[model samples]
Target: MPDYYISQISHTDKTVIQGVTALLNAEGIRLDANLDYTCGMYDDEMNIIATGSCFGNTLRCLAVSSEHQGEGLMNQIISHLIEVQFERGNTHLFLYTKCSSAKFFGDLGFYEIARIDEQIVFMENRRTGFKNYLKKLEESSALQLQTLTKDTSANTATLQSDNALPDTSTADRKIAALVMNANPFTLGHQYLVEKAARENDLLHLFIVSEDASLVPFKVRKQLVMEGTAHLDNICYHDSGPYIISNATFPSYFQKDENAVIESHAMLDLTVFTEIAQTLGINRRYVGEEPTSLVTGIYNNIMSEKLPENGIECIIVPRKTDGKKAISASTVRQAIKDNDVDTLKKLVPESTLRYFESKEAKEVIERIRNSGNVIHY
Candidate 1:
């Protein structure tokens, strides 16, 4: 065995943490900004030659020096981290590593979850890591459905609770899916849905059901359902915290541009593709974003990575409305600026009626008081 000892390093251990970070940084690794726990392999000289960390069951920032390669130190470091997670009642573990080193980890029983390119691959242990997550989500969804059904009579005017997708499968039809957050749905949103509906035999429109957006989830879903009612073959589904949310891809919301979009994108797309396979969706469609940097990066990631898994990615250009591109952000800006003419042009008739309703009066006033807006 090498003359080394592994030890836990607290976040406050600045000096020792710096030593480990130096090793990882020199190896060109992206550091996790937050860590629940960390472990380091120190040489007899007390230098951190290897280091690894765990962030919410995901093992991250594992690096072994080139000089120590082939010495079985990587396995040692990983075993320590996995045990750390195991002790915390987390049997399933996930990790991100380069594609080249994947085989090394694979030998240790970590299977590939998703890969962004030759440079990056996300892997998880085979012990119900992903399967458990799906089960938990389904249970939560079922409970919510029961609650909604029970309260429908009480809040008929306030709550519109009938958004459920058909699970009926048809192997002969070419099923396509479009995941979106039509926050107070706009004409551009309608155009994309219409295009996908026109091209595919069946289109699954998954409105991002996460309530993290500025617009409430109830309002957003209602707008989308009302606006797209014209499409007969389109089915409405909920995103269920699987796409572009803290549960999957949190970096999509953070302002830090230095964060790696690759890992977040891969992790989210991995879960999405699983659901896609279950639904027999072979095509994924997205609107070409010209303004939002974060959204654009996500679109590019899907375009590149989805194809590897046999899903065709279609990037549709935004539909223009004579003066400007018809977008949800444009609609929001119009609401903020009290530009009725622009809002009327940008949004669908359903969205317009919603804006006029007494139920929407508070949201409109809030938007008016809000500052200059940029959707990312």
Candidate 2:
């Protein structure tokens, strides 16, 4: 019954930002660092009672004052954020909310995608968004299988040999997957893909499609495909919004140090279970990342969680170029320093060629202008 109004909270307005941060803190929430837009609801007395934020298509760091509980202020905030998102052309919206608060958002038309026990819940506006994603994966897998079968038959017929084709039977076939950012598609990536392709009947390669890295997603994907073109067992899949990349993961969503890391890994792996099932994936391969704390934590979480879902998680040791282990971050640093020799040692020829092309001129400039390129 109390009068209330919502307004956009400018990041530059330190006074109002402090008020919003105080309210969120009182509610045991932290201000998310990755937000592009934020808004706060004010009562008649100009007190900040509720707040919400938008990062890309995600609604994050939402909170309401304890005194305003059940006053329908959050509904107003959500509506305001939705309108803002619509204006921004982000129709398919996503959000992260506490598990206990999920039902309230559900009533507002957000469907749950995945959760990490009682810590956090990942939701989206569309009811069938995740289902449709899985269906697309299944369809893509089937199409690729058909093409591979045809190619195998043609090769066998041309050779006129009884043993030209390998066993394509489902019983003995090994289907595995690898999800990679492939920011530059280094030789290390090629090494992992080569090993996986050699050992598996089919490899579902999911390229992180989020454009958050120094190298854009389009270039990353092109380099990945071009670098692995020799491998015949690969079925490439754009991660879309389903697969969470480092860029898309909201690291600042949770206040607890370990919970932040665990929540991200758990939510991602939970969604991946369904994807793995759809593609008949029994194993996942990841390159060893011994330096980055976030990635180390994620790999550990994957090792524990994937096995519970009957999927094996394999961490392949990083491939070395005689001196140091090859990494995208290292290659990025090389690009920044214009170290052509280091670049040659780290990335595949296809990836190296891409960076040297006229098409990569802007991207090279972008990388060179960046302050830091190393992941750690």
Candidate 3:
């Protein structure tokens, strides 16, 4: 047998795992083997010197005992875990570490994607092939340096001498704004996004990625990404539970009447104001739609409230046919009726192809037959 070997540990071995847990704790790292999908690196004596865990498909945690720090133990642990994750059909891996360790991971196969705080750095690895991974790390670091320079320049431009927003700079900032349930992205949504992108420096699309939505949040987010893959400065982010719940948008789920809708709108306005402040956004972009009373009310409230919060709201007019406005509801209706022509008109060719390939017609048929016309 090799002097150093990496293998999966069974749950029956939990008692022995306490050694690794203690080591991690001593290093100021927390590990819940029961919750986190864990792996470990043990010495010849079977004492774990290094341990790591995967949170989701994306995030991972790695900690090595300080006593064994200067050795190649950390590299072995990470390399072994990466190989295991790849074998298990994971294509991407992510981790968060102190900013001081950014160069350390970057020396490995990781590339920083974002920063959560002043201290933590979020890194990702997307390469599966060993040779490709090395090449990608080099290319990614170069690109990251360029991006960082541009980002710093942009940040400086947005800030005054005291690092506060000046009164003059507030009016020129444009934001792309939209509410996405992501039930199914239609051509109308794409049109709205294209138009919004043209007018805004940054697009902040609010995806209602909550459990209440019929389509799973991840799937919806994926659809949004697929639909808007071509746009620049367009980014996707979750609205979180607070913005999607009945407490914020009761009208979305039809839980409340006009009064609740108004209240919910007020909450959404407040939440969005805070979001804008955090993101350095000053202008909001919306799509034009006249059919839904809830949307009408939302637009009306936003028009009044956003300006008060120092955000200028701009509503983009929807693309129109000779007489009718394009909408997701119309596409859903066409899908129900098996009206291919109308569905084609309402959805982008790529989006229509995806649904058709997935046999979504059957699902739409069932929904129509059930007579449940609820929007999700």
Candidate 4:
């Protein structure tokens, strides 16, 4: 029989400490108890066959003896540790493991946050209720991955459209539509794209690249691509990490509209217009969603600035599902509640599967147990 328990290390547990030390040394993970940590293990007839530890807020050390491997013991221990961390208010959980372990935790909602010295993979899991922010991170990561593996075929489509642009000789005729932190690429975004594509022969879809959110930008961009793959006329490109996000548009988070307008709205308009001009883009497309105060400012700015810069502003109306406006928040709520029926109504089946595969149920369960009142 196997027994599992989690406990803090004390001076008396020298045998347990030595066993954990041996495992950590073998795995090349440094064990430091002074840091916030916990150890989980399975004891079978006085022998410790499996052991793992949570190192501070950043690292998860796990190892199992060869004899007891493949029994799914590691997963149970890891899940337990994660729950403990959540209870302790550790929102960001990190782990450094060999590349071989990638698929294991990836399935459990941990994603590669960074690569250390090209050897160890750093992974992290972000706590929920910051779903929008996490979605932004996923979009940015997808953009980076896409950039590293640039698809020439994807670029060819843009070039073909560029060739058809009116007065190609004029440098300002080509304009790209930018979407900074477009979390899930909602139908409103699709409406914006459609409006832009109708006006411009080539619509450059600039997905923001940043890690300010939990989903990892790469996954978010993939969702966008999958959602918009049928649109051959638009070109998908990353805005890189510097140009878009809260860092660039700090006013987006402000409670007051004027502060957001003065800071974020104006800054984004100026930045996009400058970049568009540099790239021979002469127009931009924006969706009219006044639900967000920041978005309302963006709409106002585009209406005012684009005309002055001789850039066309195309504002598409808010896409709605019956009376309610389609938003990422709504989809996230549906996911948290395990309302798959409502999710299907909100997103495409592919997107629905993406959320399902992310173990959104686990995320929702975490939310419910966190004792935080979730409005959705």
lDDT of each: 0.75, 0.87, 0.62, 0.59
Q: For candidate 4, write residues 90-135 as lDDT tens digits.
A: 7676665666777787887887644323234546675332343435
- What C-alpha RMSD separates each model from the true structure? 8.3, 2.3, 14.0, 15.4
Best by TM-score: 2
Indicate the worst ten consecutive residues by lDDT in candidate 2: 158-167
User: Would you list the rank order by TM-score, best first?
Assistant: 2, 1, 3, 4
TM match of model 4 to true structure: 0.51
lDDT of 4 at 177: 66
TM-score of each: 0.59, 0.95, 0.52, 0.51
Q: Report how far residue 125 has shifted in candidate 4, in Å.
A: 30
Q: Write the per-residue lDDT of candidate 3 for residues 287-316, one digit (tens) a residue.
A: 767876777787789899899988888887
Name the 10 consecutive residues with the lowest summed lDDT in model 3. 247-256
lDDT of 1 by residue, 209-297 (tens): 86656678889999998988866566567775345453334231223563456557666788788877766679999999778676678
- Where does model 3 exceed 4 Å of error? 1-173, 245-256, 359-366, 374-376
Positional deviation of residue 86's Cα in model 4 after best superposition, in angstroms = 29
